[model samples]
Target: MNKKLIILLSGLISVGIYMFLPADKNVLKGLAILFFIAALWITEALPITVTALLVPIVAVMTGIFDVREALSYFAHPIIFLFLGGFGLAAALHKYNLDELFAGFIMKTAGSKMIFSVIGLFIATALISMWISNTATTAIMLPVALGLISKIKERNHTTEVFILLGVAFSANIGGIGTIIGSPPNAITAANLGLSFSEWLSIGIPFMLILFPIMVIVLYVILKPKFPDMAAIYTIKTQDVFCNKKSYAVVSIFGFTIILWLLSKPISTWLGIEKGFDSIIAVFAIVLLVLFRTIKWKEIENFADWGVLLLFGGGLVLSGILSETGASVYLAKLVETHLVNYGPFLLVLGAVTLMIFLTEVASNTASAAILVPIFLVLGQEIGHFPPYELALTVGIAASCAFMLPVATPPNALVFGTERIKLKEMMKVGFVLNIICALVISVVAYLIF
Candidate 1:
C-alpha cells in the first residue's frame, strides 16, 4: 500500500470514529489524536521519529490543551540522562573501548557456534546494562558478521542466530536498571525512584528473562555446527588498552558510582530530585574536561532523533493525562475487565504493552501507556499501582518480532544477513510467549 494513502485513510478513520462516538468533545479528541499517530506509526506512513514529532502537533491543534501545557511534557530529567549515556557511548567507541570489550568476549567462545552464540549474547547483555542497547548492538555487529564469513555455513543458520542473539541480548539487558534503557528512565523519573530500588526489582526480572531468552533462541535457531572442534586464539590486551583508554575506563567507573550513589548523597545534601540529572550532566562535562572525549564527538554521538521522538511522546502522554483521556480509558478498561481479576488485568496490560511496542517506539509505548496503567491501578484499589507501572515499563521494551519492533531488531535486520520472514517466524512466537510469561511471573513476584 502507498504510505501516503495509508496515512490519509488513517486520518479519515480517526475523524469518522470521533464523530460517531457518543463521548465528550475532549475525550473523543484525544482518541482521534491517538488513533491518528498510532495508525501512521503502525503503517510506517512516515519516518517513525517524524511521526512521533507530529503527535504533539496533532494534540495541540485538536484542542486537547493549550500550547504551553502540551509543550511542557518534553522537558524532563530523563532527556539529560539519555544525552549523558549517549556521550559516554560515543566516547568509548571513539577510543575503541567498546570494540576492545566486545572483542575480548567474542574471542572466548573459540570458534564454536553454540559457545559463540552464548558469548556474543552475554557480551551484548553485559554492555547494555551500562550503556545504550542500540550502541551495543551496533558495536557487536561486525564480530557477528565476521563470524559468518569464517563459519562457512551454507544454511546460514549459525550466522543468523549469532546476529539475533546480539540484538536480543541488547534488548534484554536493558531490563536490569533504571538507566539501562529509555523506558526504564522514563519510569524512574516519573515515580521519583532511586537507582537501588529499581535494581532491587529490576535485577530479579532480568535474571529471570535472560536465560529463558538465550535457551529459547538457542533451540529455535538450532544451527548445525560442523566444526565444533575448532578453536581460535583470544587476546586480553591490545593497543586500545593503553594509558588513555584505562583513564577513560576509570572515569567511566566513577560516573557509574555517582549514578548509583547520587540519591543517597543528594539526600544528605537535602535535595529531593536527588541529583540524577545533575550527576549525568556532570559526568558528560568531566569526560570532556579531562580530554577523554571531544566537543565535536558529543554532537556526533548524541541520538538527536531518538531524543526528539521521546520528547514528542512525552508531550502526548501529558495530553492524555491532563485532558483526562487516561482516566477515561481506565474507566473503560474497568468496565470491561472488572470481573477478570487482578491476574487478567495485569496480564492484559502487559500484553497490550508488548504488542504496542512492536508497532511504535518502545519508549513512546511506555510513555503513552504507563500513565494509563497508573490510573487503572488507582481505580481498582486492589491492584498494586507501583507494580503495574513497572510491569508496563519493563514489558514495553520486550519487543522481538518485527524489525520495526525496536531499534536493535532493526539494526540487526539492516545487515541483510537475516530475513524479514525469518525474524517474524521466530519473533512472533517469542513475542507472544514472553509477554505472557513476563506478565504471569511478574504477577507472582510483585
Candidate 2:
C-alpha cells in the first residue's frame, strides 16, 4: 500500500471510531488515538518518531490532557537515562573504544572458524550491552569482513554465518541491559524497573540465548573453513593506543560499576534507590569534565528521535490507563482468554510481541503494546502487570524474521553476502525458538 494512502486511511478510521463508538468521551478519544498510532506503526506510514510526536497533539485536542501534562512524559526520568546512555555511547565511538573492543576480542580467537564466529558473537553482544544494536553491528561488520577476506577459499556458509552472527548477536546482546535497546528502556520506565533489576533478568536472558544462537546457526549452516590457517589476525597492542583511551575505558568501567551497585550503595549511604538515571547523567558529566568527549561529538551520535518516541508512548499509556481505555479494551478481550492458564497467557503475549516486532519497529512495537499488555495483566490477575510488560520488552528484540525487523538485520543484508531467502529461513526458525524460550522463562521467573 502507498504510505500516504495508509496514513490517510488510518486518520479516517480513527475519526470514524471517535464519532461512532459507544463509549465515554475520553475513552473514545483515547481509542481513536491508539488505533491511529498503531496503524501508522504497523504500516510505517510515517517515521515512528513522527507518529509519536502526534500523540500529544491529538491528546490535547481531545481534551485528555493539557499541553503541560501531555508533554511531560517526554521528560520522564528514564528518557534522561536513555539520553545519558546515548552520551556514553557517543563517547565510546568518539574515542574508538568500540573498535578496540572488537579487535581485541576477534584477535583472540586464533584461526578456527567456529571459534572466530563465537568470538564475533561475544564481542557484538558485549558491546551491544552498553550501546545501540545498530552501532554494535556497524562496529563488528568490518571485523567480520576482514576475517572473511583473509581466507583464499571463502566458503559461502562461513560468510553467511559470520555476517548473520553480527546482526543476530547485536540484537541478542541488547537483551542484557536497559540502555542496550530502546524497548528495554521504554518498558523499564513504564514498569519502574531499576537498572539492577533489569540486569538480573536481562543478563541471564542473554547468557541463555547466546549459546543457543551459536549452536543453532552452526548446526544449521554447517560452516566450514577450507583455509583456516590463512585467517587474518590483529595485534593486541594496537587495541589500546594511549592514556586518553585508557581514561575513556576507566570512565566507562566506572559508570557501569555505578549502575550495577547503585542500589546497595544507596542503602549503605541512607540515600534513595532507583538513581540509575542520575548515574547516567553523572557519566555524561564525567565525560565532559574530564575532556574525554565534547558537546559537538555528542551531536553526531545522539538519537533524539528514540527519546521522543518513548515520551510519546508514555503519554499514550497515561491517557489509556487514566481514562480507562486500556481497561475497556482488556475487558473486551478478557473473556476469550479467561480460561487459559497463566503460562499460556504469558506465552501468548510474548509470542504476539515477537511476531509483531518482525514488521514494526521493535521500539515502536514495545511503545504501543507494552502499555496495553500492562492493562491486560491487570485484567487477567494471574501475574503482576510489570512482569507481563517485561516479557513484552524482552520479546520485542526477538524479531529475527525479516530484514526490516531490526537495523542490525538490515545492516547485515546490505553487505550482500546473505540472501533474503536465507535470512527468512534462518530467522523464522530462531523466531519460534525465541518465542518459546521467552515465554517459558518469563512464566517460571515471574
Candidate 3:
C-alpha cells in the first residue's frame, strides 16, 4: 500500500481503538496516539522521524499536551548529547583518525584468518562505542573484504564469518556507551543515568557479549583459516603522526574524560550533576574553535531525524505518564504477566524486543517500548525500573537474525556474500544468548 493509505488505515485503527477502549478521555487519547505511532513505526509508512514528529502534533490535537510542553521535548539534553556525538565522530573521520586506528588494529591482528575475524570484531566494537554502529561497519567493510580477497581459498565460510563479524561487532559495540546508540541515550534520558553510570553496565555488557558472539560464530560457521599475511603486511602511517590528528585525539580524549567524570566534576565545581550533554556540546565548540574540524564539515553528520525521533519519543513518554496510561498499562501487565516471575518476565520481554527489532527500527523499538517498560518496571515491584530500561535498551541493539534488524546487518547483507539463512542461522543463536545475558545481568547488577 501507498504511504497515504497506510497512514489513513492507521488513523482509522487508532480511532477504532479510541472509541472501543473503555477508558477516560485522556487515557483513550494516549492509547490512541500510542497505537497510531506504533503502527507507523512498524509499517514504516512514514519516515521514522516523520512518525516521531507526529507525536507532539497528535498530543496537541488530543489535548494530552499543549504547544509549549509538546515542543519542549525536542530540545531535551539527550538530543544535544547525540548531536555532539555526531560532531566528535565527524571530527575523527575528517582527520582520518578513525581509519588510522582501525588500520593499526588490523595490522596487529596478524595474518591468521581466525585471529583476523576476532580483531575485526574487537575493532568494530571499539569504534562503535565512540561513533555509530552504522559508520563503524561502513568503515570496516572494505577492510573485511580486503582480508577476504587475500584468502587463497574461495569458500563462503570465511567470507560470511568475516562480514557478519563486522556487522555483529558493530551492534555489540554500541552497547558500550550512552552515545554509542540511540537506545542507550533514550534509556539514560529516561532514567537520569549519567555516562559513567551507563558505562558501568554498558561497557561490561559489550565486553561480555562480543566474545560470546565470537564463540557462537566460530562454532556455527567453523570458518577455515588460510594465511592472510598479504593483507596484514601492508604498512600504514602512524595515527597521531600530525599535529591536527593530535589535536583531535586530545579533544576526543578530554571529552570522554569529562563525560566519565561529569558527576564528580559537578560536585567539585558546585555545578549541577548530569551535565554530560553540556560537556558534549562544549567539546563540539572546542573542536571547531581549535580548527580540529570545521562546523561545515561535520554539521551534516548528525542524524537530525533520529534527534527529532528522540524528542518525539520523550513527548510520547509524557503523554503516557501525564495521562496515566503508564500506570494503567503497568497494572494491566502486572495483573496478567506478574505470575511469570520477574526473571522470566524480563527475559521474555528482552527476547521479544530483540525479535521485534528484527522487523522494526531499533531506535523506534526503544522509543515505543522503553517508556512502557519503565512504567512496568516501577509497577512490577520486583526490580528497579532503570534495570529493566537498561535491558530493553541493550536488547534493542541485539537484533541480528535478519538484514532489516539493523543497518550494519543490512549493509553487510548488501554485499550479497551472506545469505538470509546464514544471517538467521547465526543471528538466532546470538539473539537468544544476548536476551539471556541482558536479563540475567540486569537482575544481578541491580
Candidate 4:
C-alpha cells in the first residue's frame, strides 16, 4: 500500500477510536493520537521523524496538550544526551580514534575465526554498554567491512558471519548496562532504581545472552575448513596510538568510569540521578572546547533525526500518562492477565515488549510500555514494580528482528552483506531465545 494511504487510514483509525470509545474523552483522545502515531511508526507511512513530529500536531489538535507543552518536548534533556553521545562519536570518528581502537582489538583477536568472532563480538558489546549501540555498530562496521574486503577468497558464509558478529554483539551489548541504550535508562529511571541496582539485575541477562548470541551466530555462519584457512588474518597497526588517540582514550575512559560509578558520583555531586548523561555532555563539550573537533564537525556527526524522534515519542508518551490512558491500560492488563501467575505474566509482558520494539522505535517502546508495566505491577501485585519495569526496559532493547527495529540493526542492514530474510530468520529465533532468557533471568534475579 502507498504510504500516503496508510497514513490516511491511520488518521481515520485514530478518529474512529476517539469517536467511539467509552472512555474519558481526554484518555480516548490520547489513545487515538497514540494509535495514529503507532500505525505510522509501524508502517513507515512517512519518515519516522515526520510521523514523530505529528505527535505534537495531533496532541494540539485533540487538546491533549497545549502548544507550549507539546513543543517543549523538542528540547528534552534526553534529546540533548542523544546529541552529546552522537557528538562524541562523531569526534572519535573524525580523528579515526575508533579505527585505531578497532585495529588494536582485531590485531589482538588473532587469525582463528572462532576467537576472532568472539573478540570482535565482545569488543562491540562491551563498547555498546557505555555508548550508543548505533555508534558502536558504526565504529565496528567499517572495520568489519574493511576486513571482509581484504579477504581475496571471500564467500557469503565467512563475510556474513563477520559483519553480523559486530552488529549482533552491539545489540546484545546494550543489554548489559543502563547507559547501553535509551530503553535501559528510561526503564531504570521510571522504576526509581539506582544505576548499580539496575546494573546488577541487568548483567545476568547479558551474561546468558552474550554467549548464546556468539554461539548461534558462529554456528549459523561457520565456514567450511578450506574456507576458514582462506579467511584473511585481520591487519594490525604498530604506531596508530598517539596524543590524539590518548585524548580520546582519557576523556572517554573517564566518562565510563563516571558512568560505572554513577551512584557514588551522583551522591558526591549531590544529585538524584542521571550522572551518566552529564558525563556524556561533559565529554562532548570538552572534546569541542579543547579543539579536538570543530563545532561544525560535531553537528555533522550527531544524528538529529534520532533526537527528534526521541522527543516526539516522549511527547506522545507524556500524553498517555497525563491523560490517564496508561493507567486504564494497566488496569485492563491487571484484570485480564493476573490469573496467569507472576512468572507467566512477566514472561508475557517481556515477550510482548520484544516484538513491540521490533515494530516501533525501541526507545519509544520503552517510554510507552514502562509505565503500563509499572502500574500493572502495582495494581495487580504480581511482580514488584521495579522488576516489572526493568524487564520491560531490557525487553524493549531486544528488537533484533528488522532494520527499523533498532539503529544497530539498520546500520548493519545497510551493508547488504546479509539478506533481510536471513536476518529475519535468525533474528526471529534469537528473539525467542533472548526473550525467554531475559524473562526467566529477571524472574529469578530481579
Candidate 5:
C-alpha cells in the first residue's frame, strides 16, 4: 500500500475504534484527535505547527469544541511566553551575542580538559536556559565546530562525542526553569502556577543536575583533545573578535530581567493578572519600534515548529478536558495508584513523561499528562499538585536518546559526526539517571 493511503486507513481505523468504545462521544473524539496528532508527529508529513493547528480544527469539526474555545489556545499565555522568548532570541542572534558569549567562555577556560568540559557545560546550560534548546545548539555548534577544525586528530570519534555533548548539554541545561523548555511552560500553565514559582523549583534542580551531568559525560566519553597547552594557544581574540553589540545585549538582558521580575512588577504596579506575557509582547514591540531589532531581522528568524506543536497539543488537551476524557483517565489511575506515596507518584509521572516524550513532542506529552496528574495529585493527597506537575514539566525536557527525542538532538544529528547508536548509548543511561534524580528531588522539595 502507498504510504499516504496506509496512514489514512490507519487513522480511520483508530477513529472508528474510538467511536464504538463505551465512553463519552467527546472522549472518543478527543482520542481520535490525539491519534491524528501522533500520526503527524511520527510521519513528519506536515510541519509540526501545521499538525498542531490541525488538532483544534479537527476537534471543532468533530463537535468536540466550539471554534472560539478551540482557537483560544493560540492566545494561551504559555504560547505568548514562547513567542516573547523567541523574539528575544531573534534579537540576540541578529547581534551574534550568543556566539560572542560562547567564544568568551571557551577562551577563559584555557584548555584544561576538565575545565573545558565544565566551561562548555556552563555556557551551553546558561544559553539553553534562556533561549530554546534548538537555538542554543545552533549558536554553540559553530564554536564546537571551530574548536574541532583547529585540532586535527587521526580518529575523529572523540571530536564527534564532544560535539554531541554540546548538543545534549543544551537539552540538560534547559531543565532548569519554566522558560527553559516548552513542556515546562505547558506544565506551569496547566497547573495555574506562576512562571516565577516554577523557576524557584527549577533553578535549584538545575544546580544539582548540572554538575552530575558534567561528571557523567566526562566518565562515559573521555576527551580526545587532551593537549591543553596546544589548545590554549589558539587565540581568544580571533574567536570573539566580533565586538559585542551593546544595544542588542541591553535589550535582551532587560527582557530576561523583566520576565524574571514580572510578578513583583505586576504586584507593585497593581496590574491585573497575566501581565508576564503581556510585558514580554510589549518588550518585543518596543524593541522593534526603537529599531533595537530591525523588522527584517525579526522576519528572517527561524520558524520554530514547537509553537505550532504546542498550539495543536493545547487544542487537543482542551478537547480532552472539555470532554472530561482526562478526568476519566485520571480516575482510573487514581483508583489503582493513589495508595502509593508521593515518591511513587512522582516517579510514575516522570517515567511516563520521559517515555511518551520520546514518541511524541514534549509539549504534547505534558498536555496529555498534566490534566491527569492534576487529578491524581488531588486524589493522592500526600503532595501538592504542583509537585507532580513540575515533575512532568522537567521530564518533558529530558529527551536525550533519539534524534526525534528533542530538537537539540536533531540539530546535532545533522552534523553526521555522532551516530544514532552512540547517542542511544549515552542517552539511555542519562534518561534513567535524570528520571530518578528528578523524581527523588521533586518529592523531597515539593
Candidate 6:
C-alpha cells in the first residue's frame, strides 16, 4: 500500500482501538496520541514541526487537554533552552570560535600521536556538548579532513583511525548534559529537575566515559604513524588560521561564564520560576545586543523543526499522563519487571532509547519513553524514577551506528572515508559501554 494509506489506516485503527478498549477511555485516548506520534516519526508524512504543533492542537480538539494548557507546551522551559542554547552557539560560530579552538588544540597536541587524537576527541566532544551535533560535526569535519589529508600525503596509517575518533567523539560527548543533546534536555524537563542538577550529574559521567572511550578507540583502531617528530614540528601559524578566532574565543569564554553562573543569578533574583531558561535567553539577548551576533544570526540559530518536535512530544506525553495510559502501561511492565529492581529498569530504559534513536529521532524517543517511565517509577516506588528517565534521555543521544542515527554520524559518513560497518563496529561497542556506565552511575548517585 502507499505510505499515506498506511498512515491513514494506522490512525484509524488506533482511534478505533481507543474507542473500543475495555479499559479507561482516557487510557485509550493516550494510546492513540502516542501511536500518532510514532506513526508520524516513522512515516515522515508531515514536516516534524507541523506534526509537533498538531499534537497539542489535536489533543485539545479531542478533549485531551484544555486549549490554553496544550498551547503552553510551546513556551515550555525545555523548548526555550533549545532556542537560547542554539542562539549562543550561533553567535560563537559567527565569530568562528569553534574552529579556532579545534585548531588550537590540534596545534598544541601535534607533538604526540596519542595525545593529539585524545585532544581532538575531547575538543570535539566538548563542542558537541554545547552546540547542535550537526553544527559541531560540520565545523569539525573540515579540520578532521585537513588532518587526514596531511597524513595521507605522508602515507600514514593512523589518519583514518583519528578521523573515525573525531566523528565518534562528537556523538559520545553530547551525552554529558541536558543541553548536550535535545533528548537530554527534554528528559530533564520532564523529570522536573533543574538544568544545573542535570549538568552536575552529566559532567562526571562524561568525564568518566571520555577516557574509557579514548582507550577503546585506541585499542580497537590501533592507528600507527611514522616520524611523528616531523609532523609535530609544523608551525602553529600555518595550522591555526586566525580567521575571526579571537572574537569566537572571547564570546565563547563569556558564554561559559554566564552558563556557570546561571543558577546563582536565579537565586540572587529570588525567582523560583523558569530560571534556567531565563538565564539562557538572557545570555543570548546580551550577546546579540553586544553585536557578538546579529538578528539575522538569531533567526538562523534556532532549530524550529526540532523545537516543534519537542512540543509535539510534550503534548503527547502530557496526554498520556492526563489520560492514564502511562499508568496502565507502567503497571503492565511493573507486573513483569518490578522484581528486577532499579538496575534493570535503568538498563532496559537506556537500551530501549539507544535502539529507538537508531531508527527514530532522539527527541521523539525521549518523549515516547519519559511518561511511561514516570508512571513506572511511581508504580514500583522502590527506586527513583528520575534516574531511569534521565538514563533514557542521555542514552537517546547515543546513536552512533548509522547515518540516520545522528547528524554528526551522517556528517562524518559523508566524508566517505568511514564505512557503515566501521561506524557500527565502533558505535555498537560504545553504546553498550555508555549504557552500562550511565545505569550504574545514575543508580548510585541519584
lDDT of 1 by residue, 347-372 (tens): 88888888888887787677778877
Question: Candidate 2: which stretches are off by over 4 Å?
Answer: 230-239, 267-274
Best by TM-score: 3
Per-prediction TM-score: 0.90, 0.95, 0.97, 0.88, 0.90, 0.91
- Of candidate 6, the 10-residue stretch with the lowest lDDT total is 227-236
Residue 25 local lDDT, model 6: 79
lDDT by residue (170-227, candidate 6, tens digit) is 7777877567788887787788766667778778877887787777766776776544
Model 6 has an lDDT value of 0.75
1-446 in candidate 5: lDDT tens per residue? 46577568758876785878788776776666666666776555665667787788787788877889888888888777777777777877766677667656765876665466557667898888878888898878876766666665534666756677787778877877666788877777777666677778778888877777666666787666656432433343653454435666667777767767888998999975677778778767877876767767765663556766777777767777877777777778878877776688789889888877877778767766776777667666787866776688788887778889888889888998888888888778888888999998887777
Q: Which stretches of candidate 1 lie over 4 Å from their true place?
A: 1-20, 58-68, 107-113, 152-155, 226-242
* Clashing residue pair totals per candidate (backbone < 3 A): 0, 0, 0, 0, 1, 0
Per-residue lDDT over 1-446 for candidate 2, one digit per residue giving the tens place of the 0 to 100 score: 89999989999999999899899877888788889998998888899889899989988988889999999888888988888889889988876778777766766876576676677789999999999999899888988888788767768988989899889999999999999999998899788888998999999999988888877788888888763653545543654665666777888889889888989887887767458888888888888888888877876788888889898888888888877888888887677887888888788888899989988999888988888888888878887767778898999988887999999999999999999999998898998888888888887878
RMSD of each: 2.7, 1.8, 1.5, 3.1, 2.9, 2.9
Model 4 CA deviation exceeding 4 Å by range: 146-155, 192-198, 201-203, 225-242, 411-414
- After TM-score superposition, the amount by which residue 28's alpha carbon in candidate 5 deviates from its true location, in angstroms, is 3.3
Model 1 quality (TM-score): 0.90
Model 2: lowest-lDDT 10 consecutive positions: 227-236
On residues 138-202, what C-alpha lDDT tens digit does candidate 4 reach at each position?
88886677666656666787777777668888887887866578777666656656556767767
Better by lDDT, candidate 6 or 5: 6
lDDT at position 62, candidate 6: 87
Please give the CA lDDT of all the candidate structures: 0.78, 0.85, 0.87, 0.75, 0.74, 0.75
